[model samples]
Target chain A: MSFSLKKDKQGVVVVGVDGQLIVGNRQELKQKVLDTLESGGRKFVIDFTKTGYIDSSGLGVLVSLSKKIREQGGDLRLCGLNEDLQTLFELTKLDTLFAIARTPEEALAAF
Target chain B: MTQPQPPQPPQPLHVRRRATGGDTELSLDVPSDLDYVGRAVELIADQLPGGPLSPRRIRFNFRTAFAEALANAIAYGNHRDPGRVVHVRVEVAHDAVRVHVTDEGNGFDPKGVPDPTLPERLEREDGRGLFVLKSLMDQVAFNEKGNSVCLTLRAG
Candidate 1:
């Protein structure tokens, strides 16, 4: 997975990930989250509109990142997940663990 | 103990094709590489009959199950060793699609896989692959050795 980060007018960081998020690129994704956290961007939104695939490994990274961010008194929201990803999150019951918004704007506004 | 045989040279990844009547069957011997999982998913998607499934169902079910099975084979079965091979066989019938994925690694007990649906297991990063496969596919079964997985999807 490759990501581009931009902060919104509210200073909430919006991370747009392109391509598949699988075991092959999960480390890079984790590092991106860590780096963003280190740079003091607390509120976050992960945009998954263009991300076509995700596996257990990818979900793992997201879960871990959510936990870490929460522990640090920050919040993360997910937005733009296509149908398949939404079903995946539901199947694994991860939907309960995340705050999902329909659009990036909603996610940004959530913070 | 039997003397350990010299490590055989790694098997080259290749696909074997067979055509019978109007049906097409393919078998792929891929090196235990995670990168090939996406390629495999794409190949399967390309071969699926177009009339029975919507594009969204195709992506949600077939690709998801296939990717999970391949990931398990490489990560748990082959331990991510490139020298190992994961054999995948796909048969596209008129009414159903069947895929068999076998790995070279020592098998584990499929029955013992954790229940990801339980609230306690929800936050864990791992253990969801099999659950997803079982949830989406019409049928998912493991061989006696637990090293091979068979997934089937029936046409609606």
Candidate 2:
């Protein structure tokens, strides 16, 4: 899986994955989150609209990043999760853990 | 293990698209046209001998297994060489399909992952890759050879 990141409106960072997020690339994704945090951005809105699918590892990466940001006084929200991935979030109760929105703007507004 | 393209053609995919097999193979080399693993699973499912299955089941399992194996190959397999080759083989028999996805990267110790179900892990978001694979597939096995890892999954 490949990802592109950009900061939007000073508070939101958009992360897009080119394809599925599986076991192998979770570390890279997690590092992206850490890098963003180290660079002074706290609020994030990860966009999964372009991502085809994601498994537990991908989910874990999101969770780990979100947790780390939260501990550092920042917050992360997820947007555009497809049906299958949305179900996974709900099943694992991650939906409750992270602030999830229907769109990037909504996620940004949430913070 | 080696796939030779025709002398004058962009037919590798077209030919493989038509060929059916009981072999379980996942190629990490992304074909420009078929980049996503979902498409690969569809291609593999089409080649299965059974007439067909419920669209929902097929779609579900395809998403699950494809998400698990293909992601690993893409993210973990070619980390060192940037441009590395990953091969996948599938064995479809009467009861189930056994798929083997091999990568060119060193495999990790599976035992290192924590159980997400542990009380302390209830709020943690990581450490669920293999767990989910084990839960979804009938079986999942990992083997290491030099810099390559062979991931096996069984689904009946």
Candidate 3:
């Protein structure tokens, strides 16, 4: 799957993932994140509005992405997830691992 | 000359077929490759009847559950061997949908799968597929050989 990266005036990157976040293209997501980091991005917000489904492989990518961002002294925010996705995060207790915002504006503000 | 067996009734274009009480059924032999996974999901979605069950919810739940099961079949079951195949069957009724995913690989005990929701296992990624399937699907059953699994989902 592909993701769109939007940078606000303060340089916070809001990455919106499109289509299913499945194993077939999960690496594309990691590559995009790494690319963002290389470009001096620190504050990050991943919007899941377009992503309807995510499996364990996708979750792994997010967990690892969160850790990588934190290791670089950066913050990661997640927002706009549908209820099912929200439940997934809760079930896996991943909600405790990252800053979750209900909207992109709020996620950006969190940074 | 042996009388040609009266045109062996046109094989319903499916490898495995069955009829279940009041439910519509469809079956196909899907290639082990991941590319066909989307088609499998769509086949299940097409069987769902439009009603009070939120379309979005149905799509998400069925898609996630079906995808997880198919992924397991492809990865763990067939070992990603393109030469192998996965047999998928689906039954949809007014209130519920039933699916069976049979893979060719050596079966493993479903009970042996650890709970990914456990605190210590939160970061581990490999085991969560089954957990997600169990959580989203109404019921997840494994065959005695472990090479097959049945997932059922019902409208709320």
* Best by the TM-score measure: 1
Question: Could you tell me how far off, in angstroms, the CA of residue A24 lies in candidate 3 after the best superposition?
Answer: 1.9
What would the TM-score be for candidate 2 when compared with the true structure?
0.59
Q: Which stretches of candidate 1 lie over 4 Å from their true place?
A: B1-14, B47-52
Alpha-carbon shift of residue A30 in model 1 (angstroms): 1.3
TM-score of chain A of 3: 0.95
Q: Give lDDT tens digits, candidate 1, residues B1-156.
A: 899999776444556778797666888877787877777777767766575556766766777778889989998999989689889998877777788999998898978888987999898888888888898889998888899999988876
* Candidate 1 lDDT, A1-111, residue by residue in tens: 278888878878888888777777788888988898988978889899988778788888999999999988999999999988898888888899999999998887777
Ranking by lDDT: 1, 3, 2
Q: For candidate 1, what TM-score does chain B get against the true chain B?
A: 0.84
Against the true structure, whose lDDT is highest? Answer: 1
Arrange candidates by DockQ, descending: 1, 3, 2
Compared with the true structure, what per-residue lDDT tens digits does model 2 show for residues A1-111? Answer: 488899886757888887667555667888887998999988888888877667776787777787789999988888988676777776666777777888777877777
**Model 3 misplaced regions, further than 4 Å:** B1-21, B47-54
Candidate 3 residue-wise lDDT, A27-99, digit = tens: 8888999899988999899999888888777888888888889989998999999888999889878898778
For candidate 3, write residues B49-85 as lDDT tens digits: 5642468766788888888888889999998897998
Docking quality class, candidate 3: acceptable
Worst 10 residues of 3 chain B by lDDT: B8-17
